[model samples]
Target chain A: MADRVRVKSWMPPGHIRTPAYLRGKTGEIERRLPAFPNPELLAYHLPAPDIPLLRVRFTMEEVWGADAERPEDVIEAEIFAHWLEPA
Target chain B: MPHDHAPHPYRPDQDGPLTEAQVTEIAIRELLIEKGITTASEVTAEVEAMDARSPAQGARVIARAWTDADFKARLLADGTAACEELGIEMGTLKLVALENTETTHNVIVCTLCSCYPRNLLGLPPDWYKSRAYRSRTVKEPRAVLREFGTRLPDKMAVRVHDSTADMRYLVIPSRPEGSDTLTEDALAALVTRDGMIGVTQL
Candidate 1:
């Protein structure tokens, strides 16, 4: 089963791990990585809960739209589970 | 058996005044030393250790992997352990080698910061640290790779790995054709920093 997900478009202030451009972009889950402490909370030296990290794969066309040089190309990013929603 | 030498005059302005960041850094270091948290010699030793590392070390590893099949398998299996076999200390950071194949390609970038395998490949290039590269690479990898003069076929899949956490990635570029007869030293010579970073294809 392909776990296709869309990156949530949330802009919170202060340190964040997710990139701004990936907001609302749809991609497939490539792999599941070991859970890591949420960096947003870790930055403040607070105890952070471990979150599932997934390697998401997106076609260049999906990410860059028509501006993509090679539409067939793929880009993989490790995104936290909280930032993902079903596409 | 001593010869008299004239003492040079001290010129305070020979070097420009330190910037705000530099002043803050110096003050912090002084405070740390005054509090006995660390010594100046210890800091100097750490700096020297970092200075001793360079990309030549990574190139040597790649050359060996290209020549030895078992080594290549090990590298692909566990990058950190494979590098340790070559006497490269990875410290606490996990290093993963992304092999480039005919159907797939891999590139690495740190979107949040300039996170790189400095211990293996030395200091990153200036352009890699630029905001343009970091911001644009994720959104437009194919265009960025093209700008780097690495144009792949339209059918090939380009997988971009974002170094967002503790793990670091290194690209094991495809062995150049017609170079089977080259010695390991010669092959290592062909590996470049950008190639390992996946900005350039060998």
Candidate 2:
């Protein structure tokens, strides 16, 4: 089970960890990927997906900052359940 | 009372900026050596191998993904297996590959730290690992893309995907149109390192 969130808008700071670079964007849910447990935890120390997730889509101009001359671009993207607040 | 005896300088609450895990990492490394389970030399060798292999491998994967559609499809389905097929081997890393199509583009960044698909794309470009890139990519994705010379339409949809937890992501860009008749080698040649990151097309 996963939570959902509707990200209204993004304030892409010059730098930070939040996928703000991907904010104000939209894409289709391609497929559910995997998940991760709290990294600080011990016992089960592996890089396997502990939970399920969904990937999305975007264009180069959407995420990478492309110019107009060379257009018609896109990129495959993924977002986890943990990352969403609520839509 | 004599102005509170000369008034203390207004030093903003500077709590000696060492509470983060960086300090803990040093402590852990010292402890590891003290326990004799490992030596600094052993750790350094492994680190060196990882460092040396990262970027070159990334360039190769980016180049390969750019030129191979079947390979790209496999990556979209199962990144880990797809990587192994390429001889890059995702190994213990839970890999995920994303495609930047004519409709969408993708970029990756670790806001907390530089969590990248080193095994596949190799070492991340400095910008991809930067805090600005990470933060802005999600919020002002279009603006960021603009910096990269990528601009989307007002009507065109822009989606931002965040890479978190065990799963990592790779951007598989669409093959450029004029590249239809080119050989795989030639196609690979046109795949810029940035293309793999979804910053630009082939």
Candidate 3:
């Protein structure tokens, strides 16, 4: 089976890489990126640690439900590991 | 046609006092110069180099992919490295080339901010950075493409790549039909910035 993941719905203050629109959505991992420094910490000048990055692909139906323009369409976004959990 | 309109709203940057962001930018640049971290000439040269990059670079890549199947495979596999192989410096920008096929159309947008493939395609266009383009593309992409005069059939699936984080996207638009006999340079000439951005098809 393909790897499935869910984006965390946490709404914390300060610099965030996960967009609000993508929160709580489930998607398949399209590709994995080489680890990158956590921008949330880097933005505040904190010592940052590297974390896994993923390009997740979500269908329009999954994101917008009945309101989707074309339910079969898809949207892909880069989400950090901290913002994702195995689905 | 030159004097069709009477007048328009004045541009703030040209007439009004500098904004806080502008002031901060100037202050940092001045500080860098004072500290000898960089020179004024270096800054000018950097700007010149940036301005030199245009859609032409992207056009060249698309044309090559259309003509060479092996190059297209390499481009799809590793966008940054493949671009470097063509003498295009990708810098630190991690690139991913999204291919448009017969059944799918790929469009790129940054809902958070304008995260573009700048090194390869120069600066993002003004419309690409607009609040409307950023917000609506993901919500009602078909309508957004319609505004750009692109009307895809219902059978074709649209893939909107919201470049929210690290990775940048470049749409490898499907090669137009009936251009097989044309030279690679001629093929490159047919590619346009908007088409590469996926707002319109070539």
Candidate 4:
């Protein structure tokens, strides 16, 4: 009997999480954040909830202006969790 | 086991004095702690700190945007950086800042949750995080701003930005002329937290 692997990913629809500006707009994966159960899940079971995870740093040009007019434009943002390519 | 529509023992009406809103919050917090999303102390502490910070800072940013073109340009280019240049400390990640300029007035809403620019303006206002504001701001911005006591000129355009991710937006309102004599502090005083959210004007 093989154990089941839940193909759960954090970035998905219906989450009160990150803004649209940060998603699907590929940038360097910068770092791998620690994983924790989702907030909605935790809120379903706990008295108080805290989100535990690592943060990724993204430069501004990578976010708003990979296509922006000014090349010198540099801004930064942090996204939670890293997407893992299928094995 | 098949069809139990009966209320749970923890249902809102069963609780005393607490509104459905209060009950929902209690239940949600319980679930989060039970599931290890966050600890109670951390949530409580952070909420307290956020309440203490957002408004005053939001006021300052709005005021500067209203008065300084160079500052406004820098803010539009890189909001977090612009704030830091003005001495606002921000977390390097989990935050997004957007600017609303002339020919466009930007208003932010977090439909999923209150994903706000806590660094620049502090936490979002209660209305901004409300369902009514969230739903209508995008679909009927003029109506929404009207509720906030703002009546946009017929020619001006309103662009609503959703803080659908961790990203947030700050409204850089047009500067009010004849304010040349106003000191920075006085100008900042005119900048309301609501002004930054684009619900009201400074």
Highest DockQ, which number? 3
Between which residue pairs do clashes occur in model 3? Answer: none
Candidate 2 TM-score, true structure as reference: 0.62
Which sequence of candidate numbers ranks them by lDDT, best first? 3, 1, 2, 4
Tens-digit per-residue lDDT, A1-87, candidate 2? 223333235453443223554555554455666554434332345453443455555545544555432343444444555444343
TM-score of each: 0.86, 0.62, 0.91, 0.55
For candidate 2, state the interface root-mean-square deviation in angstroms to 1 decimal: 6.8
Worst 10 contiguous positions by lDDT, candidate 4 chain B? B1-10
Tens-place lDDT digits, model 3, residues A27-58: 99999888899999999999999998889999
Instruction: Give stretches of model 4 more than 4 Å off.
Output: A1-87, B1-48, B92-102
Q: Ten residues in a row with the worst lDDT in model 4 chain A?
A: A1-10
Poorest 10 consecutive residues by lDDT, candidate 2 chain B: B1-10
Candidate 3, residues B1-202, lDDT tens digits: the string is: 0111246455467467888988998999999999999999999999998988888888889999998999999999999888888999788988899899989999999998899998877888778999999999998999999988899987889999998778888999988899989999999888887888888888
What is the lDDT of every predicted structure here?
A: 0.83, 0.59, 0.88, 0.56
- RMSD to true structure for each model, in Å: 7.6, 12.6, 3.7, 12.9
Candidate 4 on B10-56: residue-level lDDT in tens?
43565478788888999999999999999999898888876676667
For model 2, residues B1-202, the per-residue Cα lDDT tens digits are 0111234466553466765576887798889999997899988987886766544454455556766668777877777887787687566877766666666666665555667777755566667778798766654666787787776656555544556445676666667787767776665555555655666555
lDDT of 3 at A61: 93
Model 2 DockQ class: incorrect
